[model samples]
Target: MGFWIYMLAMDLLIPLIMTGFGWYFSGRAPRKINPVFGYRTAMSMKNQDTWEFAHRHSGRIWKICGLVLLPVTVVPMLFVIGGDEGTVGTVGGIVCGVQLAVLIGSIFPTERALRKNFDKEGNRRKDGQG
Candidate 1:
């Protein structure tokens, strides 16, 4: 039971973090662009406009993915509640892996959106122009 609880807490950590960071990034990303934090990418760092756009786009993705993963993670753990430590750990690890994948996978769509909305120079596109 104790180990299960511990593993459950560990597994849930990623989703919680993703959600929290998502909220922060969505509402208030750093005003200035720097290498230190808040979704740094070649395209995103092009300018203030790109920086804010990437944060807002990725933030929304993280928020939704985290919310969805929360329930998906919990359900599997609930099934393993009374299981052995190995079983609990394995399940927890799997859940964490999925959450991690979702977290990383979020970057793609944001980059795509950035490309779709803004040019390589970070200038916003006009109408259908790429």
Candidate 2:
């Protein structure tokens, strides 16, 4: 039971949050590619090959992780929560928090670095015109 909430958070809610995040970031008012602004690294690739390649690669990884984590973690949690027969507020809360921390901290920084490197250009000085 304790582990189940963590599973649900990591496998389900986090991904859903990420999806909403993508929408919010992509659907900006000006609709510009501001990687640093949202940590969303929307690479404006005119080349179809490069675009398709990136989609195939990074998209595939995200998909696979979702596929694996969903059933292995989330579904069981749904069952556990539905069952609801024990003290699920204490240990579960702590574990769930740790799971969230690990997931967010691990992926956010790593992806931030990746986007900064592969998608976004380096920061130009304010005194520009070079």
Candidate 3:
């Protein structure tokens, strides 16, 4: 019981934290170069324009992913709370894995958006300049 509760709390808390981070950072990400904050991919860091675009895009992705994950993480808890320890653990592990997958999955769309909006030289594209 205690273990299940702990797992449930952790599953809920992590995604909530991710949502908060995404919301806060998306709105407040710095324009200047910094080592510790914002999205720092090679394409994203190509310039100030790319950096800002990447963070803004990725921020939205993170927020959406976290939002989607919050309820998903809870579903397993409701179903497995009264089950045996092994079932609880398995469900908890699977939920956590899904959350991790969501986190990783966000990168793809963000990078794709960045590429769609900007060129390799980090210049914003006009209408159909791909």
Local accuracy of candidate 3 as per-residue lDDT tens digits, 25-91: 6886676867877788888888887887787777777788789888899976899878898999899
- Number of backbone-clashing residue pairs for each candidate, in the order shown: 0, 0, 0
Please, what are the lDDT tens digits per residue for candidate 2 over residues 38-110? 3333342423322333333344344444344445444445545744535344434544564466445544443
- Root-mean-square deviation of each candidate, in angstroms? 1.1, 9.1, 1.6
TM-scores, each model vs. reference: 0.95, 0.36, 0.90
Highest lDDT against the true fold, candidate: 1
Q: Residues 1-130, candidate 1, lDDT per residue (tens digit)?
A: 9999898888888889889998989987799999998999999999999999999989998888888988988999999989998899898988888988888899999999999999888999986255
> lDDT of model 1 at residue 48?
93
Best by TM-score: 1
* lDDT rank order: 1, 3, 2
Global local distance difference test of model 3: 0.83
Alpha carbon deviation, residue 65, candidate 2 (Å): 2.9
Q: After superposition, how far is residue 82 of candidate 1 from its true place, in Å?
A: 1.4
Q: Which pairs clash (backbone N, Cα, C closer than 3 Å) in model 3?
A: none
Better of 1 and 2 by lDDT: 1
